[model samples]
Target: MAEYTTSKPEWAPEKDDENKFACGVMSGIDGITDTTVGNLNPALKNGTMKPKRKMVLSVDDYIKGVSSGDRVTLARAITLIESNNPKHFRKAQQVLQGLLPKTGKALRIGITGVPGAGKSTTIEAFGNMLCDMGHRVAVLAVDPTSSVTRGSILGDKTRMGTLSRREEAFIRPSPAGGTLGGVARKSRETMLLCEAAGYDIILVETVGVGQSETTVRSMVDFFMLIVLTGAGDELQGIKKGIMELADAIVVNKADGDNLLKAKVARAEYERMIEFIRPATEGWRTHAYLASAYKKTGLKELWDVIRAFEKVTHESGVFKRRRDSQLLDWVHSMIDEHLHNLFFDDPVVLGRMPEIREAVLKGVISPTQAVAELIHIFDVQRATQRHVDLFHPENQK
Candidate 1:
């Protein structure tokens, strides 16, 4: 029942707040007048008020909604954050700008391990413990996007049913989009939004496949690697990259007959930690045995996280790491954006079909096609430069 004013399109802005317009109940357009607007049936307006197409939620609206604890708005904000559209990308940045200062207070933890390591179950138990201690938690689970369909399984909700249903917890499963980043493109923005929304703990769960472990390590304050026992090749198969990044190694499923093997794995991980240089200052990575299914040893894990948080927060290293991560993110985003722009040029797009036809016809090799495309772009730029030089407006 609340009426909200709609801002101009992302491409334009009004001169003053007074010129800002309200979203019509039916049409998302702002300029409809009393004569024309009233002529439209009220029922048509009510039936056609589609939020998805007409007006995408701005970052300001998203932050306001989340801060006010509106779950539907929060979900929509995450969707906008994950969108790949150029306009959505710009809007997402606006949202992050407003939310960044309110963030950095939460403990950002990244957790990864091989499939079947009970990662979700561990997160549920760990999240429940934090909630019991009166902390609000947000979990970001990264699922691999289907290469064929470009969709994700989104099974985190089903796997962490109990924790997902918690009032104080928010669970979001994001598609990796085959980037090898082990997270959705906008996960960092989502993290800031979650922290701004008053979550004291932010857990990022990534698929434990090889290079993704390294990606997860670069983004979090603390990295926890979960593992399971009874896999005889555990130590041998565990990559050095994953082992080196782990701030804490948790051998989950340690209850019942798995207890002995879990202890053995824990000791092995401890020894492994000793060989790798500690990743953080004044923090010694440790390993523990736990059973997420049985809800045992979760308290110890929380204690370890709390200890790490306290030390990092006091030393000021946490803030430095976040700043460094932001720099890295900026550089990466710039490179990706420019790369997309170059490839998405109309000149490039128009030539793609011709290039493909040449390749199909065996008239040009793939490498030759690339060379020809580059040559075409170079020639086009040269012609544009000539035209500009000839124009009197270019004299300046």
Candidate 2:
């Protein structure tokens, strides 16, 4: 047999040949026509190896997980507390009850600024600096929720890219959920949980709402406001109440063309703060200038915070404030529980429709309706106690 050679005619389909579809010169510049690839790795033949199913954690498991500084567990614990569900709420409370002793050890700092005032940028620089100093930093950045949809903007982590990737740093962006202070309803509890997880520095970023300043002040050991230059004194003048709440204020974006303006703003703030009582006892509030983009003034800001902390601690105001805050938390919780109970109580629910109708029809005054509702509530409580004391099953 003759060996195959070019003596064989070069095969070419005719113009009208049906087989021409399968014959064509390779076009290197042709765009990708399909996404087909060869077989996947054999190890993933049945299915890609998935993470193990998370084990159901007990209260003790949650406590131990947080104490050991497990980020996954810490995040899950926060979610548990943030839940509005009753069962999760109970479990979250139990977790906090067990971890209370470990809390109040961290420096709680609240940071706020107007929209576009570079809050997330400053936080990234500040948090990265702290992490480099061998400190564990946890950032709870509260994002505003949409009034109509109740959804969050939730892009803080995206802005703090460098710090978010650091091992010693943890960033959690939580929705404000209509909370007044720009802090979420569970923010204080979440901070306590982070403290138990051994974070030495906790930075809470508010939603930048005007009223949030006072609310943040109530919950944090130190409150710092980041303000921008070139916005004129009008913004500052309008926010005097917020200014009075700050332990310190930093004029951010102090580089480029804004440097001089920043210096002037810093001076103006210092003079304005002089007349107001200092937020922290035994410490004077100060304003400094910074460029988060250039990473300047951060060290000075940290120094001022340390000075405030030291002075307050020495004056015993630190402990006193913590005690006062704990009392406030108790009262706030009581009020919230009472509010829920009022609407959920069987007697209140049964009579509310009639009372509301009567009030609307002018048959009873609003105040009278309220008094009548209180009377019904008292009567129901008395009846419940009597049943608990005499009921056959309850006796056992």
Give the poorly placed runs of model 1, Cα more than 4 Å off. Answer: 1-60, 236-240, 352-396
lDDT of 2: 0.81
Q: Enumerate residue pairs that collide in model 2.
A: none
Best candidate according to TM-score:
2
Clashes of each: 0, 0
Score candidate 2 by TM-score against the native. Answer: 0.81
lDDT tens digits by residue: candidate 1, 150-182: 999888778888888888999988888887756
Per residue, candidate 2 scores C-alpha lDDT tens digits across 290-343 of 989999999999999888889899999999998998898889877776676677
Q: What local lDDT does model 1 show for residue 392?
A: 42
Candidate lDDT scores, in order, read 0.76, 0.81
